[model samples]
Target: MAVSGGIAAYKSAELVRLLRKQGAKVRVVMTRSAMQFVSPLTFQALSGNPVHSELLDADEENSMGHINLVRWADVLVIAPATANTLAKCSHGLADDLLSTLYLAATCPVYVAPAMNQAMWHKTVTQENIQKLKSHGVIIIGPEQGDQACGETGFGRMSEPLAICNRLMDETPTRCLSGLKVLISAGPTREPLDPVRYITNRSSGKMGYALANAALKAGAKVTLVSGPVMLSPPVNADLISVETAAQMHAAIIGKAPAHDIYIGAAAVADYSPMITEQGKIKKQDDQTTLTLTLQKTRDILAEVAQLVNRPFTVGFAAETHDLEQYAKDKLTRKNLDMIAANWVGRDLGGFDSEQNALQVFWKNGQKNLAMTDKNQLAEQLISLIAERREYERGNKNTA
Candidate 1:
């Protein structure tokens, strides 16, 4: 693991601990600036090895630490990869030990970027990132959220557990190779007037994570997303929608060509029967207002009922009776699977980074304990792939 200079450098320490806990043999390499936020001794204690930060050290083999470190590593990871380090690597400048090691390493490389929101959105920084991707380096999160700089956007380093899970989920074999996946995400709005709308608390974290996981499994992905602050995963076909009706249309129109459809969006159950063209004005005598609501289309059920439906997956965010509600929905909608989790909780629900799920299908269920949404998404995708293959095999034999 390579740590660069940034406030997120502290997160790298936790990442090292997670990697160690997962039984990985970890080695730490740091840029000189990284040590400003975190001490080398801290990493040395977690990694159980001496930390490497200098490009040249007299005590090392042939006084060449970069070459030796590259040889010793099976994979190279740079967490909190600052803009400077990214630029250096992109331009093939190896003035520092971390960049030199990146150039020297033969193993797979992963970079998790962390910077201010403005810096992350800069054209030059994005270009550098694209260059790294073109060279086969895996880029992880710079997730959207509050940053140490008192601004909010896409510049936070992915959580330590999420980064660890992503590293662990990496495999040579692509499970969903050649498959096409369609996913819906985020909370759909139901407009009452030109200015006001009804929507849920969904943050679309899980859906985005699933899209990324499916992509990692080598599937071609289409993400039909509602309004969200997140940056869509690289290489996905993104279709943006704002309302439940629009989401329904997008998903229905695109479902047939897909091999898998995961309905992760929280579409509004109902919408105003009549939408006012202009904002409703307050009247002096009117203290109360009433409006009728009509049921919105059921996207999951419609997808499942298609003549040649894709393997359908649904999600149920319940406040109570999770198993009952989930199972009922699975049967009621003729879904292949349903993932249910408790909402209105202190942890692991809408708008939060962590989540847990009780996944159900006919005669089977699995409890995925609360964890980072990214990790959970990877597990769920694996399960979906396995179940899909099993069902296909059974059909062939029958």
Candidate 2:
């Protein structure tokens, strides 16, 4: 969603690209004032959706035009939400399609205010913004800095990508909001003293994506990361752990009261039962040694059985028999939902940016097709919201 009326309107195209890249469907609406700076085709090409610019068109109004588009948005985003558009919306003046939709919307509306700095500080504009917010519209940042006008201050429309990024990462769905969510990512090194260790093929992409997604959906995220070069999501309470023991310690201490636990880290299933205290010698040609393998603590199951357990999500990576193994894990771990994937596919489960997931709950399932992890995260978050609400409704009725 974009509104045009300021120079910042140009950045909206980049925002559309980012949103679409992340697998979000974007539709754009432009105010008449916005048409002065950019053409509708520019956005149409970027959004891949028709750029809707006029409130009344002979080709459109005959079809009951704006009212049709009015109902079709998961969220309404307005960039460069002009003073005129803002006043109209805040005042409930349905003189235009955009304003009319503002009044009629049943979904969230996010406006990125962009205007001259002085215009932004005006009492009338500020009050109108307050009015819109009071009525439930979201106000994304109009970060202060340089502006297209010679002078600069507050009133730059956030770059289009920034607006979508904020929407995806910070809009409070409470699907995981107000809940302490602890997740781990990457592979841990199991040390046999200070000189030797072991690890796995987990890149932590899936886990980190989950953390980012969960945080975006409003969860307080705690990410216990292994020694991967991955940067933890912004705002995640990050704890860097090096070995299975350290990871276990972190989880044991932090997992108890968590509202949702996603054990997506590919923790080593086996550790050397007897690790030599120091580095082993380069022995003779024919030498045999017996080493015992022991099971690490089952993190997901442990969290699932806690006294006041939160909803639990699990991940299963499989080479074959994906459904059988995933279903088994879901029941065995007492997970509320399990996202399963195949490792040997072309998608490269360990390090690829794109992959597919088969998400399963009790009686329902969804297939997340090959796409960027970020987009899949969005779909997953939306599902999480629906599932949580549905369960809540059931519990209340029962």
**Candidate 2 lDDT trough over 10 residues, lowest sum:** 130-139
- What lDDT tens digits, residue by residue, belong to model 2 across residues 1-398? 75657888788878888999989888888877777888888889988888876677668746555667766776777777888888988877887667776766655568889888999999999998866654446688788998777877998888766787888975556466577888888898877656877788888877777776776566888999888766556568999998787898898788877767778888888888878877777678848856677888887787778777767788899999999999998898888888899997776588776778899999889999987665566577677667767877998999
Q: What RMSD, rounded to one decimal, does every model reach?
A: 10.7, 15.5
The digit string of per-residue lDDT tens for model 1 on 1-398 reads 99999999999999999999999999999888999999999999999999998899899859998888888876789998999999999878899899999887656579999999999999999999966754456789889998888999999999999999988978424688899999999999888898999999999888988887787677999999999987676678999999999999999999999999999999999999999999999999999999899999999999999998999999999988889999999999999999999999785889887899999998999999998786688789999999999999999999
Q: Once model 2 is optimally superposed onto the true structure by TM-score, how far is the C-alpha of residue 37 displaced, in angstroms?
A: 11
Candidate 2 residue runs with Cα over 4 Å from true position: 1-174
Q: What is the TM-score of each candidate against the true structure?
A: 0.66, 0.59
- C-alpha lDDT (0 to 100) for residue 226 of candidate 1: 98
Q: Candidate 1 — which residues are off by over 4 angstroms?
A: 1-76, 79-173
| CA lDDT, every model vs. true structure | 0.90, 0.78
Q: What TM-score would candidate 1 get against the native?
A: 0.66
- Residue 340's lDDT within candidate 2 is 90
